[model samples]
Target: MTSIKTKKILSKAGYYIFVSLLAFAMCYPLIWMLCSSFKETNTIFATATSLIPDPFVLKNYPNGWKGFGGISFATFFKNSGFVTVLSTIGIVASSTVTAYGFARIRFPGSKIWFSCMLLSMMIPFQVLMVPQYMMFNLFGWTGTYLPLIVPSFFINGFGIFLTVQFIKGIPRDLDEAAKIDGCSTYTIFLRIIVPLIVPAMVTNGIFAFIGKWDDFMSALLYLNKPQQYTLALALKLFCDPSSTSDWGAMFAMAILSLIPVFLIFAFFQKYLVEGISASGLKG
Candidate 1:
């Protein structure tokens, strides 16, 4: 019994040590970026291997915030916030309704439509980008936020799938009970389903928020004016292969850019984990 107990202790210690090293490996890039942000741009590459900056300059934050073309990083942040918030709302609202229909309602061709949605998930966004760009250009939406914000109103396949799985876990007896009380389908969804599916909704909302916040491609393709640039686009302004690049400023801003996402994840981490686990197990 003593030998067995010692073996278990050794196993647990080995597991924790392995996990700690793995975590550090994964986090090293971010840590390096943070340290590099305070170093001089020229020395950044020279001492790239080092985690600690020899002489940490405080100018990077101020200089980066100054931004390019007389536009501050604040504008970029505002634009990102606008797009992310609206896109998240659109995702949650549209996906929730669609998931409800797919999960709870029995209609002709419902299964077929759900299958099509699943199939849609298999198709990469790159395949549709050209056609979408052409269509948006024809609509004169290439330079506008419409192209970025409009498509989010439609069914988000992953979000719908996640919500549907979560909704499936909910007892159907609740729906029947609501119906017996003379509640309409819409009424039941609003009053009964929505409240119970909070975890799934929060999960989808967090995913949507992160996706929109980190979306560089869509923003780059749609927005042309520097004033209308998102934070991701603004980051590009710091890089110029043909000329001097403010590596320090870029890294500083990049670190600052991560704060919102980090804070969000830290706060909603419990819900995110619970939602994903519950959805996976239930649906």
Candidate 2:
């Protein structure tokens, strides 16, 4: 019995050590980038494997913030905030309502609609990008944030699917109880369903915020003005294939861009895990 206990302890220790090594390997690129941001631009490539900067400098932050063509990096951050926040709100609202309908209300073709939503998730975004661009351009929304924000108000495939799964897990008796108490469908949804599903909504919001915050292709395809650039788009400006690139500033801004993502994950990870686990979709 003692030998068996010792073997189990040793196995657990070995598993943890392996996981720690894998985690460090996965994070090494980010760690290197952080260190490179502090190093002089000329030596960044020279000290590729080093995690410590030889001569630390604060110039990268200032230079990156200065931005280009008289626009400040603050503008990019603001634009990202505007688009991402609105988009997240839109997705959560739209997806929750759609999910509730599909889950509780037995309408004609509801299963068909649910299946379609799931199918949408299987289709890659690249498959629809060009046609979507042309449609938005026809509506005269190119060069604006409308193209980015409006579609989110209508539908989000993964968001709807996630939420539908979550709502299905909720017992229908509460909804029936609310109805028997003379509550309208909308009132039941608002008073009973919404409150209980707050965790799922928060998960959606966190994902939507992170996804939209890191969006580069949507901004690249629709936005033409530098003032309208997002952090992801503005970061691209640091690299000029025909001219000298500012690697230090790019690395600095990259680190800053990741801060919000890290913070959101840290604070709301419990909700994320709970929502996914409850939804019956966890892999």
Candidate 3:
């Protein structure tokens, strides 16, 4: 019995060690980027395998923040924050209402409409990009943030579907009780269904924030001015393969750009996992 227990303990230790090694392997690139950010640009490529910076310099942060075309990194941060916050709010608000309507209300062609919405998700965004660009261009919104922000208010197929599934898991008895108390459909949705689907809303908001924050293609296509650029676009400015590049500054800014996303996920990961799992199960 003692020998068997000893074997089990050894197996567990081996498993944990293997997992730790695997995790480190997966994380090595990020680790190397962080380490290289402190080293001088010339030394970055020379010490590719080294995780420790022999002569670390703090100039990368200041230099990167200085930015190209006289636009600072601060502008990019502010732009990203504005877009992300608004887009998140819009998605959660619109999707919750739409999801509530689909999940609870019985209207003509409701199932057909919902089916169509779900079907739209399978269609790749690239296929629609050209037509969308042309439409926005006709509206004279190509040079502004409207092209990026406005569409979010209309509909997000995934957000609506996620929320509808979660809302369906809610007990219908609550809606009945609210109605018997003379509550209108909107009131019942606000008072009963909205409160119950907080997890799904949060999940949608997190996804929206991440998507908007990391959005490069839309910004690239619509935004022509330097002041309108996002963090992703600003990072691209660090690279000019046609000429000299500031590798150190680029790495530093890249590391800094990841901080917000990392913190958000670290703090709200439980809600994300819980929301997705619960909604998926209900569906």
Candidate 4:
């Protein structure tokens, strides 16, 4: 019995070690990018195997800030911020209201509508991309942020689904109590439901923020004007096939672009975890 217990402990330890190594491997690229960003162009090639830069440089940052053709990093940052903030707010507010209706309120065709919502999630964004682009073109919204920001007002299927799951976890007794106090449905949603599901809101908000921040293809396809480009699009400008790429500056910008996302995640990480956990528990 003693021998068996010892073997089990060793097996668990081995499993943990394997998992840790796997996690490190998965994260290695991000670590490499961060280190490479601080290195000079020649130094990067020299210290290819080393994680730490032997000679660090801060010039890459300013170089990256002034991207190709004098396009400023400030412009990209501002554009991205505008789109991300508007989209995040829209997604959170719309998704919350839609999720509340689906989770708690009974209405005609609610079940069918809910099923349709799930079905929408199964449809690939690629399938819709061309049609969406055509629609935007028809409205002459191309080369602007409208194509990116406008759709966010409509509740995203995944956000709605996730929020619904979290909302379901909240006790209906709260809704009933609110009703007894002569609270309207909208008031109940505002005063009670919104507060209770703040964790899920944070989770969804973080996801939306990240999605907008990292969006590359949409920005590439829709934004024709360099001045209106997001960070993702701006990063691609650093890669010049005509000459050797400014890899150090490119990586530097990439690292700097992640700062806002990191700050957001750090701020709301606890709520995000709680929201996800609570949703699963309810489901």
Candidate 5:
């Protein structure tokens, strides 16, 4: 028994060591990028083998911020922020309403419709990209933020699925009790159901925000006007085929881009995990 216990301890220690190494490997690139962003251009290449920056510098941030097409990085940040916030709000509101109906309300062909929604999640975005672009062009919505913000008002498959799972975990007794208290469905939904599902709503909103913030392909395909370019698109402005690449500034911008995502995740991480966990539990 003592030998078996020792073996189990060794196995657990080995498992933790493996996990720690894997974590370090995954995080190394990000760490390297951040360190390089603070180093001088020459030092970056010279110290390529070293992860630590000897002479730390912060000039890359200001240079990158002011360097992109003579436009300040603040403008790009504003554009990205506007689109991300609007998209997240629209997605959360629409998905919540749609998920509530699917989970609680009985309507004609609801099951089939719900199944169809699930199937839509399986379809790749590439398949719909061209058609969507054509449709946006027909509406003359290209080169504007409308193409990014408008579709979010419609139900998103992942958001709907997440919300539906959360709502399903809610006990029907709450609704019945609210009804007995002369509360209307709208009131119950707005006041009670929404509050109860705060975790899920927060999770979905965070997910939507991150997606809109990080989106590159959609922004690249639709946004033609330079002024309307998001931070993700603006990051590519540093690329020049003939000139030496501004690796330091590019890395700085890349690191800057991650700040908002990290903040959002940190703020909502608890609720996101809770929502996911609760959704999987039996009511």
Candidate 6:
């Protein structure tokens, strides 16, 4: 019995050690970057093999924040924040309503519409990129944030799919009970379905925020002016082929760029698990 207990303890310790090593392997690049962000610019690559920045230089943050072409990173951050926040809100609100309609309402052609929405998820974005660009250009929205923000309000196929699956997991009896209690469909959605799907909505919000925040392609396609550039696009400007790229400054800003994504995930992480599980996903 003592031998069996000892073996079990050994097995658990081995498992933990293996997981810790795997996690460290995955995070080594990030740790290296973080350490490099504090190193002197010229010595960054010279001492690249080292994980600890000797005498920890602190100028990278200020230099990177100075930005390019007389424009600071503050502007880039503001532009990104504006676009990401608005786009996220639009996607969550529109997707929630669309999912509710598809999941709860029984109208003619509902299945057909839902099938089309699902089909959209399979289509590559590259196929639609050109046509979308032309349409926006014709509407005179190409140079504006309209192209970035407006489209998000219309539809989000993944968001709809996720919320629909989650809503399906909910007992229909509660909806029926609400109806019997003189609740209109709108009221039922507002009071009952919405509250119940908070986890799903949070999951959707996190996805939307991250997608929009990291939307370099969309911003590159639409925005022509420096003032309108988002953080992702602005990062590209830091690389000047004509001159030496400030690797240290770039790394500093890159680290700053990661903070929002990290914070959002950190705060809403529980909802992600709950939402996935509630949507009937399994390991």
Off by over 4 Å in 3: none
Q: Residue 156 lDDT in model 4?
A: 94
Find the candidate with the highest lDDT and give its number: 1
- lDDT per prediction? 0.94, 0.92, 0.91, 0.92, 0.91, 0.93
Q: Best candidate, TM-score-wise?
A: 1
Clashing residue pairs, candidate 3?
none
What TM-score fits each model? Answer: 0.98, 0.96, 0.96, 0.92, 0.93, 0.96
Write candidate 1's Cα lDDT for 1-283 as tens digits: 9999999999999999999999999999999999999999899999999978989798999999999889999999999999889999999999999999999999999999999999988999899889999999999999989988988999799999999999999999999999999999999999999999998999999999998999999988889999999998899889999999999999999999999899888898988998999999995
Cα error, candidate 1, residue 247 (Å)? 0.5
| Pairwise TM-score winner, candidates 3 and 5 | 3
- In candidate 2, stretches whose alpha carbon ends up further than 4 angstroms from where it belongs are 281-283
Error of 3 at 212 (Å): 0.8
192, model 3: CA deviation in Å? 1.1
- C-alpha displacement of 36 in model 1, angstroms? 0.6
User: How close to the true structure is residue 101 of candidate 5, measured as C-alpha lDDT?
Assistant: 96
**Sort by lDDT, top down from the best:** 1, 6, 2, 4, 5, 3
The list of candidate 5 runs beyond 4 A from truth reads 1-13, 42-46
lDDT of 3: 0.91
Clashing pairs in 2: none
Ten-residue segment with the worst summed lDDT in candidate 3?
189-198
In model 1, what are the clashing residue pairs, if there are any?
Answer: none
Candidate 2 per-residue lDDT, tens place, 1-283, comes to 9999999999999999999999999999999999999999889998897889999998999999999999999999999999999999999999999999998899999989888888988998899999999999999999999999999999998888888888888888898888889999999999999998888898999999999999999999999999999999999999999988999999999999999899999999998988888876632
Give one digit per residue, the lDDT tens place, for model 6 in 17-81: 99999999999999999999999888888998899998699899999999988899999999999
The 10 consecutive residues of candidate 1 with the worst lDDT sum are: 51-60
lDDT of 5 by residue, 1-283 (tens): 9999999999999999999999999999999999999998778988988988889899998899885556788989999999999999999999999999999899999999999999999999999999999999999998888999999999799999888999998889999999999999899899889998999999999989999999998899989977889999999888878988888999999999999999999988999899888876734
Tell me the lDDT of model 5 at 229.
Answer: 92
Clashes within 3 Å, all models in order: 0, 0, 0, 0, 0, 0
